[model samples]
Target: MSSTHNQEKLKELLTQYYLNTNEKMVFLNKKGQVIALNEAAEEVFSEDNDYSQMTHAICRRCEGYSNEFDLMSCENCFLEALEVGNGSFQVFMRTKDDKIEPFTASYEVIDKTKEIYAFTLHNVSPQIERQDRRYQRLMMQKTISAQENERKRISRELHDGIVQELINVDVELRLLKYQQDKDELIDNSKRIEGLMSRLIDDVRNLSVELRPSSLDDLGLDAAFRSYFKQFEKNYGMHIVYHTDFSSQRFDSEIETVIYRVVQEAMFNALKYAQVDTVYISLYQGEASIIAEVSDQGIGFKLGDKAKGTGLGLFGMNERAELVNGSVNIDSQVGRGTIVTLEVPITDKR
Candidate 1:
């Protein structure tokens, strides 16, 4: 009798320390009823709540558990599948604040004869969020790389093969003008030459629009200059360009992302902003490259109804994520708009 009493005292003393710890520990019976819980667990779940609500504390908090086939499924519950031993799995639970979130849970049989089990929950929401961001960044990089490579190949084909062929046709049409003395033939030759000239210009413009060779050969600084020249001619809206980034080269992917983001910002301003002029700034920060596009045009509320399909801003953000970068847009109704992109410098300094 003294031995059993001493053992019970020892258990009480040890539980006193465990009950006060930060780790949430809960006990369950074989029927999945809550038997006991530590102080930490009490904060996460209710111990004294009755089954008048047709639920136990564990069932009230637990939404579902993860299995091999499903992210969160209630079909095969962890309580039923859990053997009389140790096991770990992800479980989604409703917290005290009533938010459904993920928790890394472990279950084990604490007393085999009594069929009592221990269940512990460690919140893993933050870790899952970080992991998701990492995966998105990686996927964005690969997708952009593939797109740029294909664009480069198609651009070269149009500029070299198709443009050259069209130019030769222009020369032939011009030669036909002098070869014929008949008024009818001369008129036909003149019209054909005019058509060929326009066609050649269109092809050249399309090639450059697809992918500028200057971007590949010279770098972002030169490429932006060339693109802006075309931009001004096409839109008649001037861009007051400012740059601290000279001919400095970066990784091809970074350059592409920057150029594409800047290009989209300008187009968004042109399409929506009721202004004729925009300001673009490109520079290198401590260990990052930054670009800003601003305009004193008619800006709209950020969360107001979108002017277009709403995919333009989304695409810019997705592109920035490729380099572990970010895009921030600031705008206010009746004021102006500013879009900024910042990407870290990785190699190719």
Candidate 2:
């Protein structure tokens, strides 16, 4: 075959490959004229794409752009860097529908003398959205942890210091009642005793909410028993708590994370599941300590718009990760949701 015929055939083959590929591709001249566009690019940019106006139109609709980044079209503008043959990185672009979409784009300068550039647009919107959500979850988890730590500090102060002072005052009032003959003093002493009793209960409840003393004092088994009993009473949700973790002492952090994750999962069940029963189980399985919180409530669609801030599941996952654990949630529309967390047990002994 002649050299010119071979070149033409090679061009046809390359054209067929690109047209068949799923990604969108477009070629533009230095003066910003649309020289060629593949089928997908034609659909996205539209058949009647006004090259003159749409050339820089993308800059106006893109997100996370700043003048400091020199991002008029894309951050690096790979088409402009074709001379160096370095592919520019992830860039956000605007669709014809005015929606900002993410793309992993690259450009190759075909002819330096002619200034012709061929660009490829790989749709990465789904991946970018997933990454952004993961970041948001991490931030929310840190915020929740900080808030809980603050509450714990305050609860400890109230339980150890302020409540003790109140108790002392009540004791003094009783002593005064015994020393005085006035009926008014005796009545005041009774009122003070009642107030002190209520205050003590509040203190204990606050402390438990912050850091369950039972978990610290007794361990996960006893702590869970008290927690579930109270959960059933408060939420009217019957939780069938089962455990084969007899006398198992988990690392303090591991125990706390597991307990809190189960607690949140239960709360999610009550708030969204709408069922009356949640089954919880914990035991040593293989090299990990596994905790499962399953509820027979109305389930939810994963990755759908959450009823609330959507942080419940996110928080649970974060807590599990803190102890080298993993959380899995399974649910459908009518079926109940099951949240499972598995933490690798360390052989510290």
**TM-score of every prediction relative to native:** 0.54, 0.55
Model 2 lDDT, residue 38, Cα: 81
**Where does candidate 2 stray beyond 4 Å?**
1-188
Candidate 2 lDDT, 1-349, residue by residue in tens: 8999999999999989888987888776776566777888754566575664556433443463223334554545444445433544566667778777777766677788998777677788788789999988787786787678768888777867777768777687757746656786777777777777767766676667668989988888899998888777767888898888667787889889888998888888888888888999998887999999998778888878877766677778878889889999888888888899999997632
After TM-score superposition, the amount by which residue 228's alpha carbon in candidate 1 deviates from its true location, in angstroms, is: 1.0
- Cα lDDT tens digits, model 1, 1-349, are 6999999999998888677666678877777777667777765676556422333456777888876646755566666666512557888888777789888788888798998888888778899999999978866776687578768977777787677767777777667756646886767776777767767766666767778899999999899998898889888999899998688999999999999999989989999998999999999999999999999999988878777656578779989999999999999888899999999999994
Ten contiguous residues minimizing lDDT sum, candidate 1:
48-57
| lDDT for model 2 | 0.76
TM-score of 1: 0.54
Off by over 4 Å in 1: 1-179, 182-194
| Clashing residue pairs found in predicted model 1 | none
- Alpha carbon lDDT of each predicted model: 0.81, 0.76
Task: Work out candidate 1's RMSD over C-alphas.
Answer: 14.9
